[model samples]
Target: MKLLLTLCFTCALLITAESLNCHVCANQNCSTSTSVACPAFSVCSTVTLLRRSGTSTTVTVNKNCSTLPSCPSLLGSETEWSVNQGFAREARRQLCCITNDCNMRTLAVPNSVINGRQCPGCASSAESLNGSCNATVSCEGVEDRCFNSTTLNSTQLMIRGCISNNLCVLQAIFGDLLSGSIDITCGAPCSYRMSTLLLTFAVAAHKVLL
Candidate 1:
């Protein structure tokens, strides 16, 4: 009788442990979907040029994340672990965007005649008039905003740049784990930490760009 009781107790304990373990996996997937859905500024709009002259330009601006589903709700239960995790993920992403200095590489334009006019000189005096001028120029201007968005399976984070022209620029993508609504629970800390850490690693390694 003692042996049978001991076996039964052990089996019950094992079952409980399995249930808890399942929670961990579920939480991880949820957090991942949230991160995937987190919208960055780039994904919302494409780069535009309001005015481009002599290697410089002034771009208009738009900074609204309402269209994105992943935009974190500032009004939700702040104390909840999922909320904290989401905020933390956003913070870590913002850090990466700032620290990594993710911007377009400006290619030097060669001095050449465009439509029978001498083209303006680039920073480098050496004009590429003789070389092929087909190279496209990618410049970084001010008024670029980043934000988060929610989606069905993944969160969409984007960064939209306002250029001189009236056009939307989609800059980058950060796919997270959660989608739709996030679960509010204490078991989300690990998921949040792991997701942010993965983002940091990808940024550092240049696998992900802003």
Candidate 2:
């Protein structure tokens, strides 16, 4: 009887050890779903990014286990994380939960509202994409920002577009993570037509990497 009790106790411990699980996916099909045992003391998270330019919009979602601290949304009760990348003319939202399989639900993407703001817009990479801005774009929703992003010892990336006002508040929450290599500066509407000169980021890096 003693041996049997010991075996049963061991089995219970094993089950407890394997209880934590989370879903994992990366910018893949919205219908696709899978789950795996989460690492010890980890929480399930979901990161959703929405990119819009011209008249087109795209959605990207990523779900997985994260050890990062839970980010509570201050803007609203349901929305946990949101950012308007004025530089790249993109927007993002995130949700984080601790309950098992809590991240399985789909999140609603907010609609863009034109706020009469404008800024330069363009995209460039080492590879030939030839992204350019013919003119400034009208800002909508929370997109009332002008942003600049520069990489260190690498290609220069610029995003001039409308961004949400909440983005500035969110940036403060991340003060613990910013580094010299990566800098994001955001402000108000820019000139009607603005463009950035492609240069070795080694020089621009000096401006932000203080």
Candidate 3:
């Protein structure tokens, strides 16, 4: 019984060692005998398994290894990626205006001049018809004028614009990384990378709100 137990322990240790050993293949095409291995970035084609009989034997086999889809390769876990993407998408949506009324506008007359002033004719053809005003009566260049007629408030517009601009800038900087423009580097662990990016985003957002 003692001898049998020893044999079983030895066999278990050998199996554990074999399982722990990671033999990365060099060539895209690899066999059990080929010692060369592919780099970390390259796709793995097959994994070699060793069988211990009277003598150790190498077993060559093909494996169905799937590659990760191309996306912004931000260093983070899946949850981090999801949160960042959600924030970015929301910011973009807030920034973009589908209707003509709520869109951002540049004003010829500053907010200081138009505040608390009720000049209906200020935006009427009557002003153009009169000799007093030579310019067209349109709300084209004025942000305050645009919002004055819309359901949104000045503060809301400002916040939306700020958030959207920040999101766009970040997206532009990390677009390639997110869109899988670069291959995944093993050195930048996903969790660490995500924390750093999220921290930067949060800081920027806080500053903007302040």
Top candidate, metric TM-score: 2
Task: Answer with 1 or 2, whichever has the higher TM-score.
Answer: 2
User: CA lDDT of 74 in candidate 2?
Assistant: 20
TM-score of 1: 0.14
Q: Evaluate model 1: give its lDDT.
A: 0.23
Whole-model Cα lDDT per candidate? Answer: 0.23, 0.53, 0.24
Q: Write the per-residue lDDT of candidate 1 for residues 171-191, one digit (tens) a residue.
A: 122223222332211111111
Residues 1-210, candidate 3, lDDT per residue (tens digit)?
999967855653343332121233334434222223332322222222222222333333323221222212221111111101111111011111111122122112111111221111122223322423322211111111111111122221111101112223233322332332221111111211135778899999999999
lDDT-better candidate, 1 vs 2: 2
Q: lDDT at 139 for candidate 3?
A: 16
Kindly report which residue pairs in candidate 2 clash with one another: 87-159, 113-140, 113-141, 114-140, 142-164, 143-162, 143-163
Cα deviation of 199, candidate 2, in Å: 39
The best-first sequence of candidates by TM-score reads 2, 1, 3
